[model samples]
Target: MQSPAEDSTTHAPTRDCDVLVIGGGPAGSTASTFLARRGWRVAMLEKDAHPRFHIGESLLPMNLPILERMGALDKVAAIGVRKSGADFPADGGGYNVFRFERALDARCDHAFQVRRSDFDRVLFEHAAGEGVDARQQLRVVSVEPLACGGSLVSAIGPDGPCSWRARYVVDASGRDAFLGGKRRIKRRNTRHQSAALFSHFEGVERREGVDAGNVSIYRHAHGWIWMIPLPDGVTSVGAVCYPDYMKTRRGDSEGFLMRTLRTVPEVAQRMAAATRCADVHATGNYAYECTEMAGKGWVLVGDAYCFVDPMFSSGVFLGMHGAEQAAGMVDAALREPAREAALQQALRRHIDAGTDEFKWFIYRFTSPAMRHLFANPRNVLQVEDAVVAMLAGDVFDNPRVRRRLRVFRALYAVTSLAMLPRALRNGLRRRRQSRVDFSGETLQAEES
Candidate 1:
């Protein structure tokens, strides 16, 4: 663990570490701990305090093996929050609830619904305690790749500020790459754009059976909502909206979130007499991509590389999976100079696969046809089970996911025509309304 003195040192450390990691989210936490366990001296800097609020409470069924490999399952299970599966509600007044039991991999029959604040803090604390030179509340103000053979990172924190020179720097900085600005690699995506507002409450209505312990998706006219059940009986509910729908809100974050909920009958009925957990939370312009996720001396993990719609619960899974793939390369890059070219290529391939996996569902998630299809399940007999598994987050390590995703890609390409055209039509109508002859409403007195 990093001591208080280390937190305040101003000058860069004369001694270098095997790896310097910025950001203490799950990806950073996992990478630092894993590398440390392999006998490498690892240093991690987190900009925020522990137990800080975060989203993405729903876990994919596949997250267990990674947690187990990190030897943190007991820690995770200690604060275990039960999440049986998902219930997808559609705009056409229909839905179907799917459980992990229906998955081809029955071993992954369940996942947890956690408060990200607690869940992330646990990983950070564990990594620190496990001998990674970890510092909480440490912000990386600057990152300078050494001219010769390392990188220097300057950071600010509660105690004061500090910096270090590291042979290899792992940019597990989530989406807010402290170094991203330096590289000018971050930019928003407009084609498949989105925004979101979320909050937690204790009394949100839940369904019976597996559905009660599951996350619910309620589709509305403008967008879709997610209801996630957490361990302490608090449910996290949020909605992701299209760019144009987001523009209508202006500054009415709370009112907009509440009103959108009412647009969905099932969600409105459920929240009829419910109360807010805290103030309504809002986030917008929620799409971005980084031109570079890795480099000769660093790798960006989790949201730092790219982010799309969060509908699929791929945020945490993809983030940590990227860290896992970066592990082998980081291990090699630490000692072997000749291995970097191969490592960078491997890193790019891995990032591409992760992004493709995530983009598959995100592109189709908001399509009316997708909403229709999920609301009413179908397909050839050959693809049903695999589709179910894919929906359940059983993509990794399963060759079946590729075959099923290919089929889904075809389904979306054709069915989306009917949906995208309607969405475009609605946007055009709204734009025309905004342009209506407002001059008539104004009195002629000013002209006179």
Candidate 2:
């Protein structure tokens, strides 16, 4: 994939659309595809070109229905490499492999891991093929909400400045919610603060049995590491560390990623057998939320509303879920005048649920005890199924997860007493193993 710097030639100036989707990530693509299918003239703008490189390559089985609904299931499946489940490898020799099909969440019976570059491109092409007017390299420069209750969007594409008007807008704009910026509604999350450094590689360790197609979570002192296998032989590896742990790094991504990976014995060994394919990349403090998810003339979808951490690969799942709601909301707003208000309210509620669903686990992932639990042997079939449901990203309509989430929350409070000895012993061992540079400030215990 070429860098934005390399693709300097913008397309000829253009305009006009019923719905304008900014950002062609999973959220934008899903929303745009659905809107276009609804017979709305949808035009999508993507700052980055398709086949663009990106991290976060894992998927949940529940997301397949959205792809199917968009008529891209076969296409996605073709490009997709099947993901049976996830595996957790801790500091000790213990490893846990979880298959979503084995869980109570029947929706996520299966999933996949695609190179984001290919995955994003597939979805974009699907949206365009579905008759949505869309283009890449069109950067949204300014968004002006008009007095008539509409919006005027000025953009800088491969060419020069151009403008377009829309009666209503869908901020399907992934993480960099352009409209959210204009609304001055972006808010940072304080719980489970973290940073990440990632890169792709070939020859990374993968289980040959049922584990051959799986994601591996390896624990480290600073935090944890993720290994995702793609359709191709290459595997995606990333290191997630607390904000304080990152502060001790030399401020260089490649060095930081390599250094952090080396900290985890399992990840270090697997990476040692593999080779990096590109420059190491890094992102920081993964939390952002908008004040209101919906408005008089627009609604937020995907990361436009809020983004929790990527620990459970919920970004794509939540984004697709939001699109599911927005498709209905947008359809209603266009069909009936009275339903418009109610539609926006529904979108806001959807966003709230999406945020809470992901935030719950984001907070738990950082729990030292939780991490250890995955490392050690503890199997309550129901708890395993509940967690598998959560990992499946089936928060939408998952009464099982919601109930178990409550149970876990209460269990965590009580288990704090039982795990006190284990926590203290592990904490001290980790402290001695890694250089404790940060002040002894404990991380917050919430996910979102």
Candidate 3:
């Protein structure tokens, strides 16, 4: 059996495992758990302890099946607030509500929004229960690929520095992008430069009945905001805006967030009587993609590989889904070394497929034509169902869904043509806005 050296005074002994996974977020936990179930000796190093706070609290219908496969669906369901649909409210006083039940796929009609701390802990603990050598409070500092095959990973935990030798490595470090950063492959997405300021609140108003748990998206002059309802009556509220807007911030994060929140009448009205229940948080330059996703001894998954806008709450779903895909590829690579190239290609295809499916909508989220389409969704050509299916994260593995998406894209194109002037104007404005760099500036303005 592979084990660490016992002599603490000497150089730290190198341990061994079939695979070493970095980060314990959804991607790390999912991949490690699945690999362990496959009988691989896996060790997962997580920088944070379980039940820790995390930002992505929303889940898509597609995530449910993966949870079921991991045998954690019941636990997730118990902690999650049932989310049946989503609501998008435009500044013009019009709105559109898309229900999951209306999606092209009939099996996945509902999802949930839970406290990420609770959700992640459930998955992490499940990984441990499945016999993964899961270690918390351990941060992977460096990973070096061995010439003979595999990698040597160095980490610092509560105890001190430690090292491990593994046949393969999986980087699921979320935004940390440990391996990607080391390889200098993480590239900022120039097309979608954005930032977010958010927090949780109690007493946020909810719609009656089935729509109570529906996540609400509100568009304002600055950008868009999301208000997601959680099971304990605590709602997650956040705004995704241009980097310039975030760079104009002033005061504390909470005050700046509140000032910005008050600008959106729809969101403001809902939060009028709400009480802040958590510290406000801000994140800038929220979109990026790694140029290389996989190589000989390592692979990047989830936010470690790419992070798009969170408009559709695709973060958790994409992370977990990528994990699912990586798990299979890792298994294949272990069994057949010669198939590494094929496995890498498959992984890339899976990642690209999901990102490409959502990126168009994300990039055009602020455009007038896209807004019009969303505000007035129609069933013509089964486009609405297709859009709903996309929101449900059903873009992959369904030929029918892909065909419907093509129709929806065609319709969007026609709509853009009909409003060419406005579309052109919005497109130009977005291009200019995307060029803004908020990285080096300290925002001082009280409001945007």
Best by lDDT: 3
Please, what is the whole-model Cα lDDT of each candidate in the order they appear? 0.75, 0.76, 0.87
State in Å the error of residue 109, model 2. 2.0
Q: State model 3's lDDT.
A: 0.87
- Ranking the candidates on lDDT from highest down gives 3, 2, 1
All candidates: TM-score: 0.89, 0.89, 0.93
RMSD over all Cα atoms, model 1: 4.6
Question: What are the C-alpha RMSDs, in order, of all predicted structures?
Answer: 4.6, 5.9, 3.7
Candidate 2 lDDT tens digits, 2-90: 11222122332336667888788988889888888888888788888878788778888888988888898888888777888988864
Candidate 1 overall lDDT versus native: 0.75
Off by over 4 Å in 3: 6-10, 90-94, 423-448
Instruction: Give a tens-digit lDDT track for model 1, residues 34-130.
Output: 8888888889988888888888887777778788888887888778677777788644565676777677545577778778898899888888877
Which clashing pairs does model 1 show? 174-304, 175-303
